[model samples]
Target: MPLKSPITVVATSLLAAQALAVSVHNWWDVPSDFGNIAELQSSIRVPQGSDPIKTYWMANGFGNGYMGMQHNSDTERRILFSIWDDGQGSKVEPIRHGDNVTVGTFGGEGEGAQSYLVYDWKAGDTVYFRVQANVNEAEDYAEYTGYWGTDGQTWNLIASFRAEKQPYWLLEPYGFLENYGSDQSEIREGYYGNFVMINSNGQHHTPENFQFTHTDIFNEYREVWDQRLVEQGKEVYMRIDGPADQGAYPPAHH
Candidate 1:
């Protein structure tokens, strides 16, 4: 069975301290003509036994189209990067079709990508993620690669896929921390940090290089590690907390 959803939250005592706050944001909106984003990278740490029944993708994007991670159950996780094609979602599949990674079909045949086993994720360990997109004009296809690592330097190729007629750069670069599960009287929180984006030209951009258009916070109910909690728009720090109504928006404070 897939792992529980990759979510976050805080305990009652922790909440009382006000030391824990949930925050999420849709940062800088990258233009589709940004000459094609070559690669994007980020890191996150989930505390031990801090599981909530929701999905959380530390970083995600969508413009003409997009790709990202979805936390299914504790055992089932996926690195999804897709483009609109053939009236169906053409996603990246796994390098291997076994445990840890496998082919997933949802909407129809060839609709899902590599599903991962995230429930076994080591507690307090920082996992690094990288996604690369390249255009293959000869075939008019866009190739994408998902890489992961633990040391923060060495990355293992997780999966690679191609989408037809998706040659344009994807827009909307943002970090997401969510508790899609409806867990009132509690908040799901995760630590997202060390974000970097590499354009097709190989130029690096960080929070220090851009302004973030903050979205997805509903006051005390939903918040981010912003000036109210930490340095604003630092990018190195972010959080998502709430009891989402149908796994989309956050609910009011309990």
Candidate 2:
């Protein structure tokens, strides 16, 4: 249950040849045994990328799933954290609050709206993120907080908001790598480790504590290996190969 970016459409017509769609995600969802989650924290190596405007990675913690850390080709290669609300009913979108400034907003077609805040993060730095939830007793609401910093010792508050709808404490966390540009030569890589989720009752869970599954954008009828994940000891890593050889393996772990 990593954060899922809105899918991008690269081609509009069959005549468009090279403007094919491209995207990849590696995810690990919280199992039913994990129960209600209070907070999730992880240290992710900012991927080495050639084009800052075309390739990116996100290490995220999901609450009510629509929230967590984000790094994309947009916003000039800065880090972002966002909170989202279901885009239907009496819920107006959550407004930006706290010390975090708004970087962007996304919502449409009956989907929830996401308000993102920016941070100065460079590639190759080991950035840590934490997504935690709290309840406002007066209003009987859920507040989600996002934090980020170098390593995991110190954390800077990034963003927080009260969900339009009360969110339960069940954080389903995941990580993903994507290359949106048409250039197939540029490769993006991220090493995700230290995945820890604290359940509502304050029980902590790690990658070593649960069984995981690997998923990719594949067409079983035609056969394609678009993306995947592999477990390296206690840590998990991801690879995004462009639509090509289904038999090609992920690049050796760095």
Give per-residue CA lDDT, model 1, range 154-244, as digits (tens).
Answer: 9766556665645544334555554545553434444555667778788776534333333334565543223112245443333344344
lDDT of each: 0.48, 0.51
In terms of TM-score, the best-performing candidate is: 2
Q: Tell me the TM-score of each prediction against the true structure.
A: 0.63, 0.68
Clashing pairs in 2: 36-200, 37-169
lDDT of 2 by residue, 1-254 (tens): 23222111111111121133343344555667877677878776645552245654566635343333444546644555654444334242444443655634544312333455565566667778787877554554567777777879887766666665454453445555555455554444556677778877888877554323223234441122233334554555555443333223544321
Off by over 4 Å in 2: 1-21, 29-31, 47-52, 63-75, 89-100, 108-120, 135-140, 209-233, 241-254
Instruction: Give the backbone clash total of model 2.
Output: 2
Error of 1 at 156 (Å): 1.8
Worst 10 contiguous positions by lDDT, candidate 2: 6-15
lDDT of 1: 0.48
Candidate 1: where is the Cα deviation over 4 Å?
Answer: 1-23, 29-34, 47-50, 60-99, 107-114, 209-233, 240-254
